[model samples]
Target: MTRAPAHDLNAEQAVIGAALLAPNVVAELAGTLAPADFYRPVHGRLWEALCAMQATGQPVDPIALAARLADSGDLGKVGGAPYLHTLIQSVPTAANASHYARIVADHARRRQVADLGVYIAERAGTDTDVAEIVATGRAILDQAAAGSQWSPLIPLGNRRHLPDFPGYVLPEWVANMVYGVAEFTQTPVDLAGCIALAALSTAAGGRAEVEVRGSWREPTNLFTVVVLPPGSRKSAVFAAMIGPLLTAERALVERTKPAIVEAELAARVAGKAAEKAANAAANADQSGRDTLLAEATAAAMNADAVTIPVLPQLVADDVTSEEAASLLAEQGGRLAVLSPEGGIFATIAGRYSGTPNLEVFLKGHAGDMLRVNRRSRSPEHVEHPALTLGLAVQPDVLRDIADMPGFRGKGLLARILFSLPENTVGRRKIGADPVSEQVASAYTANLGALVMTLAEWTDPAVLPLTPEANERVLDIERAVEPRLAPGGAWGHLVDWGSKYTGAVVRLAGLIHLAEHLRDGWGKPIQAETVERAGLLGDYFAAHALAAFDDMGTDKSTRYARLVLAWIERTAATTFTKRELYRGVRSQIPTAADLDPVLSLLEIHGYLRQLNAPARTGAGRPASPSFLVHPEVHGSAGTVHGLPGWASRRPA
Candidate 1:
């Protein structure tokens, strides 16, 4: 695939030409133009227009000129007429002639001033005398003619050109004054005139125009250049001129050396303002990060305060000193273990008290302890025998007990109820018999009541697992019957048959039994079991028969047939060849019954005279196989089985 052009340089070139010829148009072609535009013929045409305009008396109006350009199919060739028009319109108006002249003059003057200083400094090499520097500048200017690259002069419509002058005057002929008078005599003519000259050279490039404004107090030498490339309103070339302009301004200031210190003060103020803005932004960012962190911390603390009932219990039996230390560090509080007489048995108060070792205190204490701690506040301790001991229990064990038959909360009562024998409900049930009425009543009164109370106290999702356990408990709810009804025995047998090791055969047998029971006994059984068994048996039989047939031997078939006959005889039935064949086939035996069945049918006169054989290349007999009775093969037996060697006997 052909790659499309990234930029349409032909279109850009047309716009550039239009922009350059426009009246009062300024050019700042300091750097390389787009490479494509450089090789195009349009650049020469634009240059010719500029030369023609300058050489002739007639001035070119960008609007009228652009309108005429519309006829030149070449200009509109790139299909960018609209873009070209907008670019032409952006060119500065010629009507602002004085303003344009001032800009041109200021640009040229700055260049002249810089050139004068550079020339003086170069010539003064090792000679620091101000007069020598002045003489060096004059000599350089004398060598450069009007419109020369190094000259501090601008070409003005061919009629206005620099005249030949011997020496320079202070004010009138001081247009080419050197840095000596500019620095020592403190003249404004040298600096101002140099700026105007630099502006003129820049305007000839056909890209952008520069306008300058000067201030003594603030030294506000503003250089404004319009960006070029026609469509681009901002170009790097325009921005680049700012650095040179600032440099020229500083040079002018140093040469003048006036006491107007306001410019320096203004610069200092601007610098400080910039620094203050940067500092404030940095501080605001830091403050935002700190506020976010604080909010996150508060949210984490609030979540931790709400207890989840399903939360797994800690495995530790007693809180160790390490755990206590950690808790103390986290809470920034104290832990204390005291005696009933108000004497300190063990005081781990302060940062060490609330550590995970609280279990140790519970294990040592006899009475139940009161855990008086607000969720968000410091915890206090009170001792009570029953309450304290419960805190030491494992959560999983507690969950299991709560789910036990008729057990409840209040550890003392739950323990008392658990102490009874497994068969005993409350106090009357004994042995492996059903629970007595008296025991049931007591259990309902004491254990059941306690369970109900605990259920109410706990969260719904985390209430005792008792209800779930009770639902799954196995028991004889209905009276047992002595004998199974007609369908009942078969249904139970099918279920029991599922437990047999040889699942396939047993399943098949169950199916046959169901059919026998249904047909002979006239007992209707579910049709699903019969269907499933039939399907499974057919699959097994097909596989087994295929295995035997693949053996391709009469002996193999006879042995397989014998196995099937024995099975049928043991089961007390005259096994039809089909049924006997299926049982052997279902086991995927070494011998298949298909050939044997064919042989049997042949002997039984079912099959008549067989076909002959073909001769091989070695003249040996080739026993070709053929179709037989379709009923024996089970389908349209167009396809033959294995070759029968007996069919190929010497004819």
Candidate 2:
């Protein structure tokens, strides 16, 4: 009394019949369904023939298929001419061939899994090392169970269509580089544009604050994160945008080196003189000791007063929150953390001490007073710290960090501007032209000049808004303030929406400075520049809404999304819980972990769990399986805000 092999006779016949009746169905299922997926030997033979005929430009009607079978000497073995007609009559409609093919493939996978299980059991019973047995077992199981967790591509309920980046809003030099990098790398301009603002922030962060209104000012520093999937070539975009800042930092260091050397030499000589005076005071008579001690103290004070400036450090890639604070103090209260990875979030989430250390980042973005007191070392303090953040990371990081202890609770997420750029992975043109030398040179020179020029400001320059600009800023504030009410459009995002106008003001400052890079101090920001910043603000607002919504998704929903991505890739129509768990074991560690994910998927209309057959005899019942929606294999519209969404073309 053994169980029959896992397969579906009806699905096999239906797929064969559909391929014979309509050639187009064969083309649709060609990628996912192979001849070996059919349960019956004759059906597999006929499917192979039909595929071969299609490949060779031959028609695949019953008569033509029979002739092909005869040529291959498989006609008599396949039950001859009558069986071909029978296959054609089995399918009621050819349009359902993809659905039938999925069924066939699913059953084939089930049979393979069953055989694999038997093989593993036999190996386990052998006189072999347990590690060897487990290793070999996992390898074969992974190969067989690769794609069972796949769910159909469907939009989550909270997903929103994001606005395109307002590349036109940037100044000509900035826009030229944004578009040029976009063209060269074939990525969205949003990435380069956001980074451009961050670069600008690095230059002018602590140097200036834009006065929005009476006693209301916004710092030029910004925290911007662009979300893209892996393989989007984000690093290339970051390097191209951040290269100028690195060059300018080196130039600034070189320009200020002589003064630094002079100050350092003076401090050293004063310290040596103070040491000699202290020794002389120790050996002097009681009356002279007091005078010599006073002199030594005076010399030590002069040495401390002759402070040597720290070398100009404009950017840092990886540093802990404490290190960032020290760098800010060393560099006149300005620092930018620019990276292509989002590991900074983990670092900020207390990766070292297991306690959240967000005081530096929290105060950095707000331009608040930051003081760091340490034992046995000089304390570090900044009257107005301006820390800029420019990061490009995979979208999943947003979901992952949402659960960190104080990331959202402390308003860290709210303070940053998020951009969810469209991923252009598979459609990118190979051997695309590189950025033109003229555009590249102009961008490098202009951005470098702006950074260096702003670094010279010893005091915060108030970039005043024109009368028209002031009115527009007021209007934006008014419009946004009401939406933050309890039942308004932005009620759920009060923290983020409350800071929208401030972000706009900061953007306006960056735009104005970029427009007049060489002589931006004491200048008024025009209404047009504010208007462009407002548009850019709107773009970020839409993306933030989408990003926060995605970040707010529960663990089960996120896991369900991973499952769905697998389903769409494999086009799987049915599977058991054990099967799905094995396929997604990395994300979903155990079968128990998959239960809630399956329930969520079922709620989202991606799957329906079928009841197990009534128990026969005293043995345990079989595992329940899910039936995937038929439309999963059909022409569903594109799903945005999900993993693997199609990338949009260049704007």
Best candidate (score: lDDT): 2
Q: Which lDDT values do the candidates have, in the order given?
A: 0.29, 0.81
lDDT string, candidate 2, 548-584, tens digits: 8888887787688778766876777778877777777
- Model 1 over residues 543-619: C-alpha lDDT tens digits? 22222232223443435344433443344222334444455553335334455654553433223223454554786
* TM per candidate: 0.14, 0.66
> How does candidate 2 fare on TM-score?
0.66
Error in Å for residue 425 of model 2: 1.1
Candidate number with greatest TM-score: 2
Clashing pairs in 2: 150-566, 150-567, 151-567
> Where in model 2 is the C-alpha error above 4 Å?
1-155, 286-290, 555-651
Q: How accurate is candidate 2 locally (lDDT)?
A: 0.81
